[model samples]
Target: MEVSRSMKDIQWLRHRVGQFLCVGFDGLTVPSHVNDLLTTHHVGNIILFSRNVSTTEQLIQLNQELQTIAKQGGQELPLTISADQENGVVRRLPADIPGLPGNMALGATGNAQWALKSGQLTAQLLRHVGINFNLAPVLDVNNNAKNPVIGVRSFADTPDMVADFGEKFIQGLQSQGVIACGKHFPGHGDTTVDSHLQLPTINHGRPRLERVELVPFRRAIEAGVDALMTAHVVFPAIEPKPIAATLSRRVLTDLLRQELGFNGLIITDCLEMNAVANTVGVGRGAVMALQAGADMVLVSHRLDRQLDALASIVQAVETGELSQDRIDDAYQRVANLKKARLTSNRRVRPWAQLIEETRTLQHDLAEHAVTKLRWESPLPPSVRRVAVLVDERVPVMVAAGDNHSPVLLADALQAVRPDLHSTVFRFPETLQQVRTDDLLAQLRQYDFVLIGINGGENKDYLEFVHQVHAQSILNVTLLLRSPYDAHLVPQSTNLLALYENTPWMAEAAVAAMFGGTADGALPVRIP
Candidate 1:
């Protein structure tokens, strides 16, 4: 079929190609560069990070401004605004927003309904803020205990458990009008490396990949998931080369689209990650991602990189490096999704009512997720001198999305013990520092001690726990992050796993510490 090459047709094709690019920018409001991307460059979608979010009103206003800009830019469809509101620590919302304890927390409860409810509540929260697309419900089966990034973000270690929770979560989001995307297909749960820092390889054979890693993603597709995000890691079983899955035709197109039968929007992970950028470059990575069958190529930060991606896509089509049919197919998918979800009349719920409802849900979920592993030691009585130590390291995994100081556990402990002395120390891996003798010497004066561990993989953190046990003082340890740390702690220690460091999880841990109820179980086995 011969296509027209007139100026009007070329402009239309440019607009269509731009729709395949989901870009991000700094700040809460629409910046001048981003405005140029939408108005002049015809970029049609955006992804919001913590930097672009603040209060509820501010977020709504900002989204409204983005839509206004898109409309004024001569685009016919409403822009699909997205955020990583994954309901746990990975969420992009502010601290005040009511949140769940995250996927592993929900998995601890062993009730798939909570996953569904969390998804529904998350959808309500996003829809109320004028955000329609939610990049969430991580379906990765976290089988590897040493996984550096996916730890508590995943639902469970087993494929069936992850699939059960993931299917319901997807149902929750799509039913409530927000698009839920199952991420990092075929899976990122077994990796020891962070894709943001470097590209990792999954060397599993085809049978192993189908049996373990591909289970949740297969279920997600069967459950009618709205979209699937490609991983940046290399899968040699699916794609022979060392190329990441995001730029692999066999992985993204043959396996995910053909074999798995997923026909929804296929979005690439941020092309700016070292996995893609350091290797093929973001511009070329974007072109390769599209050619590999990704419906949308995301360049999440840096306007220059985004522009580079846009130009690369245009040039690929102009030079016949990319087929016109392929570009049109991707555009049609994006347009179809926009018409179905974005064109609807979306009315934000009443603010007071929404807040109260979400808070109630959050509290219930936290209570259900706080697991009491074992309490060999007696609970602390009314002791005057008490020392509280917490891992003050920012999350080593960038996907954890925690950039601020962690004070939730400290604040919660302080509320209970008015005279409690708290100490915050950096992780050994974070600053190449360890727990000091001076800190332990100060703890010797206290009759009882409470320790919070977030960096369980760090040798220094585990060593500190061993040291605290040597003191023979009564103590309790809370695994504030991944519960896998429970194995690293002393066997005789009283331990609790909260799976996340949110305020709700902190309060639940404190309640359990003070002889309150924490009946949750471990979602993953400690090996």
Candidate 2:
């Protein structure tokens, strides 16, 4: 007996339900268990991270294998391979791969074209590696200086600047066939708590949100971004306590869908994060997110949680808790995205030379973006012995295993000043680990001191930097992660906000230090 057309339609949708999920797997290579999601479940998207990337060659081979597995599954849409290629600290790509100068660095340049070029270059590289989705150009306005998570990831402090640069970046990426995801919608810029730790509450009323956070998102939507990721933070103005934009009808459906008119794929930030799991647990949160308005639920980092979450969504739909129409709508939006970008007929480029060529582009962006907030004239000569002090808070590169961009800074400085004697000290994050007396002694010995503030979100490091600067540390140049760090180091000294500790920015900083012209202007205000 032949199956009825309605029955076939339902079967298509059952496969599509799996497409609604964008899940991650366990290792740097294809794990045997991933076949469970691939063949049996018909999952249509896969997220990659440091645990799943060791080298560019590995990544390329991994993507090829993933595509083969996905193709063999016989799904209508190809698996949307994606990664958080935001560069700087959040970059998931291998360390050697050329990365953009991150958002804040681009913002400091105050040139939308630089951001566009950055996005385009980034897309070119990610595409070469077989990844088509880039969760990037984070449009969050970094209005809150002490915001634990967003800091340098945000483009600017003002909505207008964020909007202008964000749209341009989106244009650059999608133009290159890589999907640009404008993230943490309704904005994750103001929160103090990290979603990886707990749910953050953003009490900004609709008016405040409209003036600040919502502006960039509206601009992104107008600019035609392919995807928008929801924030896990609760907004009292839109929804009650505990119901974040990730799982709120008011925020997601009523506000983003109806008011803002964003028809693109709406993805949830990783459900396995403490923000969602602590509140609703991953499985229940996934169901609620689908019910709320999310098109794709991202269950990254935990395989058990991913399977459980997918199972929950399917069960919820079967039980009528989540409307089948919602699933169909979401699945269709994802399908449309795959149809548009993940084309089978596109010519893939040979990337052996791509990295070298793009490294030039990445360096240009960093050079154009290094801000000279206050440059002391006749900045210390290359012959002078230099001491570089890195903040204890800098995070190690996840995939490169132990890639510290500051080492690149030291190497660059040494190359430019062959006679330069350099002493670089890594400050520990804890007060117990800080050897202030020992550090001060080295500062006194060197002809000049250069402090590298990597991830300067901690107030403790600010105070530490202030103490060193107060001792009349002569000819010091502060290479900052956030200009907000200016609060600690006064403008009386040579201050430069590279915006992030990218190697390209580090090379740019070295150039500016040795009397090279720095044309970068401040992109954010600091008091």
Candidate 3:
């Protein structure tokens, strides 16, 4: 069938409708080609990745340029700029912004007020850099200790615990008018694989899912989250098809929309992820995602691919394969989101007040989260010597491949106790190499032995803990990266799970170790 003149009028309709499609750009500045693309295709939103960001001033300039491009293209609409500012390791503005602890750290304190403070600090930092949206407050319940990616990112292992912390975080962000997105819906916290590399499958049926994974999301929705991002994992038992949640209507439309009644915007994780890109072409993935009920398709990279996908979507609508009503619905949702953002008074409050509030809450929460796993003897009146065994796999922001050896811990200990003598032992490989003679010698010398498990791989850490059966020694294990390693230490040991391995956590650990304050228990259980 020959297309009608009205249908062929792509340029006229592009201004009003097609601009809802968001795409990324190549350079730091919005190039002329990007302006042309926006003018010609009406692309609406832009997502900033690590490549697009360098400093706070640069990010603000880039966002200004993008808005200018939108205006020059004859579109008066405000461009939505988003970034992954989850704090800790996922921070984009590391230099200017203060590195705060992750969600699990707040949850560990079992305090809702700290979660609210984290949100406020995060939102203030984001607004300073002109970012309007934060894809954060990962609502997944980290029930599985073997979960590779979502361990420390999640607030806690229990749904109620996660919900308690996440609800406050969402409210804190939204209270400042920054769009808070609760993500990886239905959930990604229980999977053993990372979605960036491949698709993960969750075996829990609907009932178990409602009780565990779905609880936090449900509470977040009820608490009024501004947006929701779908996961790239598949629940084979629930959806049967091998498609990720981003492309599955059973997960997105039927479950999240109809069942849970979430009326806010729905966004895909990222089209560039292997879970979507490897299975289907970006063009088809875009079409399916819209058909599956996504308000925004986040293309982290590959601008040309996103343009092609947009063109394909336009063609589908013209050919009668896709309904114009569906297109209109998504366009309206996007426009509404932009309109809401424009009207929002997201102004910065006093910086000193914000910082003071953040510090006060952080100190309080850290004090509550420092758990005493095992204390063999009563508190000694005088300290003698201490030895700290540090794991080498934890990720440092400045250093790429390094370990959290005993040196860092000993320094922290010394900072708390000036008179205490400290010794450091760096474990190059497995703990098996640390001979029993060496272990016994160290055990005999030190009044207390504090072991720090830096990251996820804890086979050696656990074995080393079991071998050192010293009753006089207080085994204080600090979990830096993933809290899953907390289970490796015996229940009798003095264990403290800090969730994140950031510099701030190191400082918090120092304060909590010397009885300066009482840190709370583990927010999540270790089974």
Per-residue alpha-carbon lDDT of candidate 3 for residues 1-527, written as tens digits (9 for 90 to 100): 34677655776665644555666666677777677767777777777766677766787898888777777877767777787777655666535545676777777777788888788778887776778888888898988877766776787888998998889999888877788999889999888887877889998888899899999999999998989999989998668988888888888889989999998889888887778888886778888888888878877667677777777777777787667887788888778877876556655777677667666655666666665555444446465777767666554432111324446677666656678787776564534566756776667677777777765455555556666644455556676666666555555356666666555566567666665565666766777
* Rank list by TM-score: 1, 2, 3
Q: Is candidate 1 or candidate 2 better by lDDT?
A: 1
Candidate 2, residues 480-506, lDDT tens digits: the string is 556776766674477877777656777
As a TM-score, model 3 comes out at: 0.85
Root-mean-square deviation of Cα positions for candidate 2 versus the true structure, in angstroms: 3.3
Candidate whose TM-score is highest: 1
Which pairs of residues collide in model 2?
392-427
Per-residue C-alpha lDDT of model 1 across residues 1-527, encoded as one tens digit per residue: 23555766668767888899999988978899988889887898899988988888899899999999989999899899998888777888766677777899999999999989888888988888888999988989898888888889999999999999999999999988998899988899999988998999989899998899999999999899989999999999889999999999998889888998999999998999999999999999999999999999998999888889988888899899999889888999999998988888766678789889888888788888899888887675666655666566545669766543456666877765667666654445433543367667767877677777776445666677687787776888888777887766855368899898777888888878877768788889988
Q: TM-scores for all candidates? A: 0.93, 0.91, 0.85
lDDT of each prediction vs. the true structure? 0.85, 0.80, 0.73
- Candidate 1 pairs with clashing backbones: none
| RMSD, every candidate, angstroms | 3.0, 3.3, 4.1
Angstrom error of the Cα, residue 117, model 1: value is: 0.6
Write down the worst ten-residue block by lDDT for model 3: 395-404
